[model samples]
Target chain A: MNDGARLAAADRSARVRHADRAARFVADAGQTDWHDAVLWRIRGKRDAAAGRVEGWERLRALASEIKEHTLSRLDEYLAAFEEAATANGAQVHWAADADAHNRIVRDVLRARGVRRVVKSKSMLTEECGLNPYLEARGFEVVDTDLGERIVQLREEPPSHLVAPAIHVRKEEIAALFHEKLGTPADADDPRLLAAAMREDLRARFLAADAAITGVNFAVASTGALVLVTNEGNADLGAHLAPAHIACMGIEKLIPKPEHLGVFLRLLARSATGQPLSVYTSYFCRPPPGRELHIVLVDNGRSRRLAQPDFRAALKCIRCGACLNTCPVYRRSGGHSYGATPSGPIGAILAPGMDMKRYASLPFASSLCGSCSDVCPVKIDIHAQLHRWRQVAAREGYVAWPKRWGMRVAGWIVRSPRRYRLAGRLARAWLRHAPRRLRYGSWNAWGRARELPRVPDRSFGEWYAAERGKK
Target chain B: MKVGLFAPCYIDQFYPQAAVATLELLERLGCDVAYPRGQTCCGQPMANAGCAPAAEAAHRHVAACFEGFDYVVGPSGSCVLHLREHVEGAPDARYYELCQFLVEVLQVERLDAAFACRVGLHASCHGLRGLRLARASERQEPPFDYVAYLLDMVDGVERVPLDRPDECCGFGGMFAIEEEAVSVRMGADRLADHLRQRVEVITGTDMSCLMHLEGLIRRRNLPLRVLHVAEILNGSGEARNG
Candidate 1:
């Protein structure tokens, strides 16, 4: 296969083995606890900030409704966006899939004789493997976001959406910078490390020929692209370069410019607990003497939009609130997901992209519904996870052991007579079996938890006796 | 009210005291309670494992068992929610998790019950989010917990403050075995939260969660004990004879 296809296959394989990667991450108890604490703090901040809003739930409802309306008539909005963008002096490109998206990005860069590009944090590019695609085709691509830059320097994919290099410690970042950027060997301060990155990236930004950014919301009516970031990297990159490329999924459309108010009110508060991002840049028209291109990608999104049970997932605004609020993501770390958008949202979205590859993603959640609760668009995340599990099981993606085990369990619980017999046998075994036999390797539940004490009489038996007395 | 006491599978087999408490508690509240002999499981285990077809018979069995009762009440919120969501032909509105039934249906303002101990309330997920018995901690709504409200009316009962209120205990039916490592870690973390409060007892609406937490507590030989909300609300505190 081609280089891009080969890389995509390798990435899928890596994600398919999420269980092993997650186990290794969780093995480091101290790091896992630190990660959990950090993410939980973000969740707490989100809660406190969201609580202060007078009509937060109403805003979420309105946002959900707007997304639903837009998605139902996506073709119309896409046309309107393209028309308005063209009218506003911008070119529009539609990519059917990730490969096509990569090829389009390359063609755009090549036509402009661009050799260097600076990117502001765009998960769309990550999903499309645009960086590697461009790099293999002989173009220098620099990720300008602080967290993205850290991970890019390390030649690793981002671990979190809001904080891409959240898994890396300050000391590790210091070491990476020391090795790559010629910083002092013992430099461990955040300010110093950030300063070193800023100095190095400032040079790249000035010399870059093209700037690419991910669109947070693509307003169809005004033909404007909303880009939210704490760092002013998108502004610097998009303006300083001769060509600007803004990439967005087809589901990122809102019908009118006014609809942005509801989303803007919820996005930053849900993401990082800020009332608004430090920089909420709107790119309606390209800068003077610069070319503007909008690449609207529909890589497995149209298929997802047609699924009635899963259509709500498209309403995601990339707030990353669900990740912060997710217990599994906090403990296991983002890399455990082995996908671009890791955590609860990824679990739902990834399986739709490739079911056999991401079958384990849905099972990663405890289904506590915290992700759904904190979702600004009111996506029923946990319910969707449940639906995906059922789909996976039906499609025979579930392993043989689990499949037979659940089938056997289903049989036992269906009939009262067999149910009583199984309970009796289980209790008898627990009562008489030695500790070693009970807690052996074969028993997964017994590894960390003790067996419940077997009562001498079942509640059924006790209730029967109570009836006799009555 | 004629109440059908729907004992979930785990409570029927492993946690009989919780069921006994539910029975006696409902009786004390002046209801004629019936223990339907044909009732076995709520079909949640199968359905949650993504084998809903396997749970079909159990759903039919449960719906048939509780058909004639004026109201079907269960000690576990998780099972009640499963019935409401998954069971076809089942009376969704007639079925209630214990605390919800007492507070909403019975309009129980006070109970002649007493439990003299500081207990940490473990809010199980299905009850909190699915059943809406309590406002989830993640939401912006005004705080309300039917379980805690009922516990407050019982004399000599004090609730200890938890570090993270309303976190899942991680006993997600088949999830306890399917994803053992993460499940145990979550439960252990929850236990530590309660232990820090120096609680003598931890009580919740779901016994499945309690059983998992109790297993960890028992294995470590911790001083804490697990009790269903029914046992605390029942107030007898008498040890069951095996």
Candidate 2:
């Protein structure tokens, strides 16, 4: 194979080993602690915000029920949305996969003779590699969200959904701006850094011939696309350009416009603990004479939807609450997942898209169920992670050592006699074993955690002695 | 009531005192308890590791051991939960974590127990979320802690406050070995919360979690110790015998 192919293969292999990547991420103890604190603070803020609402659990149940209802009749809803959108003078296109989605977007841009395009924060685009695809086809695409723009400048995929560059320190951003955007040397002020980004993106927004944004919720009844953002970049990008293209996964549909009240309420508070995002823009039709297009992408979502056990993952609203609440995501960072969506949600979703390449993603969590409790849509995320582990094991993706070790343990544990014998031998060894031997490389449990002290007698023996005395 | 004591394998071998305390505590509560000899493990270690086929035999073994009991009680919430959820076609035996049985079944409103120390209550994840022994910190519900309620009944036992209560101590069965780095880091963070509260003792519903935290405390040589709630409750009370 060629150099590029070899490099890509190596990258894929590296991503498959999540434990190794997480270990490397945590090696910088200070940064891991800071990341943990940042995400945890967000989780705390979310809890405080959620507490103010009287019927928060009821709202979650309602949201979950609505999504379940929509998914059950997704085909009917999609057709209704397409008809409503077409009547509203917006073009509707369907893409079966990432390649089809990218091709459709490219085709639309080419037909309009659009040379430059500006995009707001859209994880779907990242998943589809839209910018790189367009760039290879000779279109200059710029990400307008400040976080996305920073990661764009650094040539890295987003490390977070809500805060794309959260992994990058302010000092690093300042250094990056100093080297690339010619900002003042050692300028670390947030206001100054944001101003620098604003100036750079403003020029691109004006020159761009078309705008692309992600749809947070697509109303089936009215065919209106809703975009929620704190920065209002989605509005600027979509309104400034003559042509607007909104890309969304088919699962982003709500049955009616009124359902927005419940989703919008849960979305912002769960995402960043805000009462509401600054911009909750609705687009039913384009500005007079400006073209509007909606590309509905499937790209493995339909396959995942068909899975009875994992279908609930499709109910996610891209709020990133699960990411904020996940302990594994907080310490390891999103980049470790090597996917667009990271955290507990990513662990469950990524395997459906590519099982072999993403097998290790499921086992990355501690199964604490925090993600499920914090989820706005009430997806059983940790339970899904456990389900995926079962899938991975059944499909022969588990390492042989673990498989065999569990088998041996199972055999011993099934019989009381063997279990007692094993316990006696293990206790004796633990009691008399040399410190060096007990703490050796083979003792993975002892590498970080100390071995528990073994008692001289088992509970069974002690119980027998107590009964004899009685 | 006839009670079967279901001691988890870890507690049976390494921390037998916890099981003994559980047995004595139940006896003090006027229940005839039996330590079924045919019992082994709850098969959680294998089940959680995605080896359910391997775990099936142990599940069957455990179900058979506790079949005839009126109520099966164990000190570990996680193990009890594992049995309830994973033991397929097992007899419909009534099982309870010790706190659940004491509070819900026995309806023990008061205890003649005492412990004169500020102890931090580590709400083990399984006991808190799995068994609903307490309202989780993430929810918007009214606060309630069964473990704290029981501990409150014990004289001279002062419960200390933690910054973030109900966080997992990260002894996730096989997860401790599979993801050792993250497991240890999470445990250390939980330890920091307890240490920050200046508590001399940390007690919880699950000894598995306490075992992990105690391991860390012992390794660091900190002036703190861990105990199962049963050990504390049983250590107190000179009550009349049944």
Cα lDDT for residue A238, candidate 1: 95
**Evaluated on chain B only, what are the TM-scores of all the candidate structures, in order?**
0.96, 0.95
Q: Candidate 1 falls in which docking quality class?
A: medium
Query: Model 1: runs farther than 4 Å from truth?
Result: A1-11, B238-242
lDDT of 1 by residue, A431-466 (tens): 998889989999888887888989988999898887
User: Which residue pairs does candidate 2 place in steric collision?
Assistant: none
TM-score, one value per model: 0.97, 0.97
User: Candidate 1: what lDDT?
Assistant: 0.89
Report the CAPRI category for model 2.
medium
Cα lDDT listed for each candidate: 0.89, 0.89
